[model samples]
Target chain A: MRITIKDIAKRTGVSHSTVSRALGGNTLISEATTDCIRKVAQEMGYQPSAAARSLKTNQTKVIGVIVNSIDDPFFSEILFGIEDAAQQAGYSLFIAASQYDLIREQNIVQTMMEQRTDGVIICSSSFSADKGRQLLANGFPVVVVNYKANENFNYSIYHDDVDGSQQLTRHLLALGHKKIAYLGNSKSGRTSLDRLNGFKKEMRKAGVKINPAYIFEVEGSEPELGKDGLHYFMNLPDRPTAIMCFNDMLAIGFLHACQQACIRVPEDLSVTGFDNITLSAYTSPPLSTLDQPKYSIGNEAAQLLLELLGNKIENSNNTHKEKVLKGSLLVRNSTSAPLQNE
Target chain B: MRITIKDIAKRTGVSHSTVSRALGGNTLISEATTDCIRKVAQEMGYQPSAAARSLKTNQTKVIGVIVNSIDDPFFSEILFGIEDAAQQAGYSLFIAASQYDLIREQNIVQTMMEQRTDGVIICSSSFSADKGRQLLANGFPVVVVNYKANENFNYSIYHDDVDGSQQLTRHLLALGHKKIAYLGNSKSGRTSLDRLNGFKKEMRKAGVKINPAYIFEVEGSEPELGKDGLHYFMNLPDRPTAIMCFNDMLAIGFLHACQQACIRVPEDLSVTGFDNITLSAYTSPPLSTLDQPKYSIGNEAAQLLLELLGNKIENSNNTHKEKVLKGSLLVRNSTSAPLQNE
Candidate 1:
């Protein structure tokens, strides 16, 4: 059996805390007590933990990872990638959820600091500069993934939301969709704005006048948000022929809502979504969405953080500190040529 | 800014390890040297990490969580529950995926031990007692959720697979369906057998003899497994009217396969699944499955671990060390009465 401080405390008749303090070389403890505890600990063959090595070398071989939520399929895929990369690099991840709350983000960061992780990777998009200031001031290494702000972080990996949105919009336009609505996620900050801007830019290029009333932004980006968006559009007197959603989750909710309302997709309305999560393909009629390459994003983010920690592995792409990958448009059963009802 | 051992080492012109050893009270170091390093650490106002507190109090306020796969929706929902419960008790989670590999499971357990987490919760059903010997021999606190094995573990929480299976079978029988098939996962050990036995018990109770050919076992439990099961059932000369799956993922795959073959659910065939995961509800026709109370299982598992750690919260149920909860049958669009043939 592995021996611990409690075992030594039991043998030496001292408190476990005293054994810990004496072993830690805390000067407040008398030399006689320290000597007695050390001798007993040595006799018991107590092995020092990696944490003990951490105290000596100042490296714990652990990385801190913060995500928006654990159950979200999008983040889960990303986490799978992160875990694979970190494991290969001989590092374990300390995972925490921020749940898109500032106080929680700060608290998680603080906890990571107290744990003295070598570096941190933030997969939560809404993580602000203020929440990360503690780590920054200490010259701690951090790599952000798909974060809105680009000024503070020296290393980051993100998907090109604007470009991906334009591709989705262009596909709809090519299919003869003139009245296209953009359903966005207001909580996603810059991601929402970028996708919206991309839709507007693509419309301008096609010489199409935008219907401002057709564009709507909701507080969330889940399937429920998409459901709510469908209700709003159905009530609109001049609802667009096609609706572009923020992500796959919202698109799924919209499709379910359509099914309940007896609206035939592409026959009555067309729908498009960004971030092609795994479930997107299994949805009824499958979903037409953008392939976000979530796993790759996470893998690259961990690699970037590893690089920042000065352990750049051989043959890694280390040239760019900031990387923005584009998403591909997947045309599936959820979208097609809208009914010509001029 | 938090001053670390490196800061003190830099000021004293000594290696960080020497500074660490000197401060930790290692006897190998000279008395004068230890005194000097301690004074420098004090002068620099270096804040001892929570790890230091861990050494003193024998607690790190961290819990290690092991799962079969990080991205599996079933496990993710359970993780969501564990995270919520751990956070409420001033604890953080260190999550790892075992991927159902024994070596990986052992490695993860070793890593968690090395980190000195207060306790561990194993959500991986395949975790063997031999793999946990390190933690066990050291008298480490462990709580398992839905583990197949009952021996060697004092605290465990699991869904009543047999009872849930019977409930699902009874529902199918009530629908006047006598021809039923069971699709199980080979890797799930006792869980698969228990569920299969439950189906058998219910069928026998109704004076129905099950066809050995109607039952099939696959190596996996994913949606892909369900799809493969469907192919096998479809080729059989005497295909059953309804198929009962081991879990929600497989059921989803089966439904998708039916959709591809133009086989209308509940009209040509009926399907049911266990562990009513969130995605199960979003399937094409929705799913008629057993709700396993995944979140509650996880929440209670963490709470049980907390109790084992001797921090039992007020009003917490600490009555049973071995608790098996029953699943409820959810009848949706999947199962129905088989067409009559004379």
Candidate 2:
């Protein structure tokens, strides 16, 4: 049988209320008595019930975190940061993956609500803000990370992809690469568009007219897609001198293809990637990419949620707050000036 | 205010008890009344509190999963599998990372207990079975994966690392590479030892004389460590023709080092790795490694936990059960016979 306050009180020859106060560390109870009662409780293996306490206090001390996919290295690093912050603040995380399914996202939110999570952090970019309306309408604290929804969330944290893309493009342009192409991921929603825009803005500034056939937006952003992009670009009648990838995974794939085909990177064709993941640094010749502070993004999102939890307002003001972090350019061996004849 | 059964009853013009019965799907309530009450509850946004329900049923419908780290690709894949199975059973997961900290693992288990998690799946290999004594003593269902502790757990699921290492060693031997070395991670506890032992066992079976200096066990298993191993081996007076790594990450690092040093793979040296991670397939020259069924291991662990939860036995049997899964060898371009001169 589970040990309760009454059992402890009975063992200590005191009332249940006294045992509760002592265990609660109430100032009214003497330190000596509290210590004695805590010792007895520990000896008896007393386990406090969060459900019972949450019923009275209306605080579960739990945070709900929804991600697109757990296996994605990007989201996993973010989750690591969130877990660190939440654990420090005495909060447990209820982690779920939506797998890009709308109904699954909604059901995850409903389950979190039923479990009485104190707040929620949506790390899934594809999660629509409209699906979170139920939580927002009920005054639950919700924070989003790199949200792609049309509707604005009360709190959000995201990396500045456009600026990062501009930095990469600027690096390539400075290396005298006029024949540069952009490889995008169709599944990345607004992120792909923002990155492409940044590339265009820099190329326009450099007085370079991008060839229509040079721009290729593929279905996915994995290494396989990057490999496919490599094949498509190499097969073109007028191949690009340099290619900017959607992310590091794509860049890695492109590099692998080049290695297999005996085409030297930065010698035959220059390549660059975004989101300087751990593997990016270890790739052969290393990759010149944009570094996103994924951990900090997650940390900031959790900090914002904790702030919202502290100041609960019954009225929904709908005045949203957002924090955008910048990504820095990391120049490495993957990029260089094009051939003199090109 | 949070909507309750009382509000549903008031809105539907029925007694609170009738509303409760209807929401509970009790057959005693008429179908028409139940449907009407449920519809009214839905319209009112009635959120059923898990705390209230769990207090009566003593089941939280929550599973606690403890991992070594969330950012690791291997563990992330396992977590994905666990999430799929648990979600199908209408269970939410409380994920905590011990990060190889013993105290943190204890605290995580304690937090899960306080939260009244129905069962826990310990994925951290470093998590000691002794620390889980409290949960076991209280009859809480516990499952461990790749557990390192000497004490056995009632339920466990792990990969057959020993067999995997032997397969890799045998592959290299079949390529006529007698001068082989083993690079291991010192921090991997039993896993590292098992892989190294397997390498030794295979070398002995092949009637190959072992070089004690060729076996180097480092403190980590990252790509950087592999790079260090490459340098260490290259500087040796009698360099081994082939090196077997503890895992793919190390092999990736070793490959990167070989590229920088202008050493040709499959022509001058051969290398093999265990645990065929996603990046292994894209690495330069690709990687020959062992593929652990990471997802299935997680799925099986969750299934076993669910079964244990269903059968709640009072007496502790202490007759532990273990499930070991085999790993398959994947031959890529990373390995070949030694040079003719050598």
Candidate 3:
């Protein structure tokens, strides 16, 4: 049975044009008329063709989200928050995972643009910043989440990593640990650099000289690196009694390494981490870490993007609009005063 | 400056209709023309309206996913797998969280249908089985993930929960645990029932009487419930020396409760959990669990949906199709032989 706009109009007691407008998803139509038309259309099992419609109104109502990796809990939570808000606003999301490859990220963005997405949200790696800026310059309404690009031309939403790292370090200092080590990813991006600086700043403020040997940079946040960091520090002639890691994944890894080495946590050594993921509390002797408001960050990013797409705010060349949320240190069972030298 | 297809046609010395057809995202156009027109469109900053094009093609190229909860690690990983496969197929995904509310699940499906989504993937609570059947009856292409419904009219992709649970119980039995306690959610769904039945089947096969006192159902899968489950069991006159939980979250809570009570894991009592999430390995003494292929399940579901949407296969109601993935148990530090006294 063929279903048509005329049939829907006849069933709803409306003109074909009105039925067409309602079926076209035009918000300008009366709610009652649109509802009536939609009911009749659903009853008739009518399906509108996407190809012919693109020729008339140039909007797809689909938002594209490009992320570096979806396996990370942090990014996954952000994606969930974005999906929640997008669903509420009656928009569908198309996601592309670039797997931290610069060329892949660029290709995904270009593809989304060609697909005629309404807007884009990018969580890119350092290698893709240039391409990201180009997309923004091309007048694509883009929102950069988590990563802070060296080139500044787009809207960005990120947690205050610098402040969060400083607070974590301060907590360690207050615990009477004079020699503290900073374990983090390779200083390749702004996030790592900012965190390293924050650690140094807090130590310097406390009149403790920064020990060059105490700081370690690694490749990834896997448990092996954490174990290697522990092994490296444990062998040092004058190893610091405490260490602070860049994120929780590293901390958990380090914790496991400590157990393997028969080194007790908060006893033989004190360890701290950032990003208070759900697994933190479940770890044996729970982990002490900093908590980033991941959900809120995603929520705000979507809210801001919706404003831009809805024309609720002026799209001007203003450089002062930035949303920087703060992170908090959550004390758990992992950190304590170093054991007295025995 | 208003850039239009006519301007691009004039610049390229082509007919406007040809340019429109070329830029209309039709695959029938030659690659050369599509490439030339796309290059010209990009150069001209031609933004195609996806909203308008979807009206004529009847193909939004979008899939709607409704899950019971987004925060659960199991569901999140499944979603990631789905997103990966969908993105690879050039399809977009829109996700909705029902929070296990039947009414909200129905509402979300209705909205997705109204938007004329190509298909939907639902991981709903068992209480919504009737509504799910109604959706399938309405000619919506749907694939149920994780949960099975009453009527087998739609596609279903899930793990072999019964086999996995029985394997876990048999493992505990081999470890010299005769008195085993079952800690799980209320038996209001097929998943819980299946898991419970698997345990009972294994126990009966071993010629052990099923102890009604050993099985306790909690209100939810929260930390509080874990603590309550422990208290309820520990208060019994003849408490089991070993316990098996429904999922990792509950296992974590149970472990925390044991910690507070000073119960030595693997020494006084052994505990096991299903769903070996990344956190399970990080827990203190690590949680022994059944590892489900969460990501693979999601990937297969998306792949199946894409195949259906592309009309790559014929629909045969008589053909019975089911993809049941097997799960393996990872023996971590959490499980051991029962204590002599208990």
Candidate 1 off by > 4 Å: A1-48, A311-320, B4-48, B311-320
lDDT tens readout by residue for model 1, B50-152: 7766866678889999898877888987887787888889899989889987878877977888888888898888777786656755556788888877776
lDDT of 3 at A203: 86
Task: Please tell me which model should have the higher TM-score, number 2 or number 3.
Answer: 2
Candidate 2 regions exceeding 4 Å error are none
Q: Taking the tens digit of each residue's C-alpha lDDT, what string does model 3 give over B116-147? A: 67788876544376666655655567788877
Please state the error at residue A173 of candidate 3 in Å.
1.0
CA displacement after TM-score superposition, residue B244 of candidate 2 (Å) = 1.1
The residue pairs found clashing in candidate 2 are: none
What's the C-alpha lDDT at position B30 in model 2?
Answer: 97
How close to the true structure is residue B192 of candidate 1, measured as C-alpha lDDT? 95
Q: What DockQ class does candidate 3 belong to? A: acceptable
Predicted complexes: DockQ each: 0.40, 0.79, 0.37
Worst 10 residues of 2 chain A by lDDT: A310-319
**Winner on DockQ (1 vs 3):** 1
**TM-score, per-candidate, Cα-based:** 0.84, 0.96, 0.88
Model 2 Cα lDDT, one tens digit per residue, A1-342: 788889999999989999989998898988888999999999999988899989989999999999988767788889878877888888888888888888788888889889989998988877766767777777678888887562667688888888999999999989999999999998888888889999998888888898989889888777888778988999999989999999998899989989888889989899999988888988876999998998899899898888888777622566678899998999999999999987
Residues A1-342, candidate 1, lDDT per residue (tens digit)?
A: 457788899999989889989988999899999999999887775756877668667788999998888778888888878888888998999888888877778779878888888888888887777866567555568788889687777778999998999999999999999999989888889989999999999999999988988899889876767778988998988878999998888888888788878888867899988888877887777889999989999999988888777754421333347899888999998888988673
For A130-200, candidate 3 gives per-residue lDDT tens digits of 77766666567788777777346457788888899899899988888888998888833777778888999
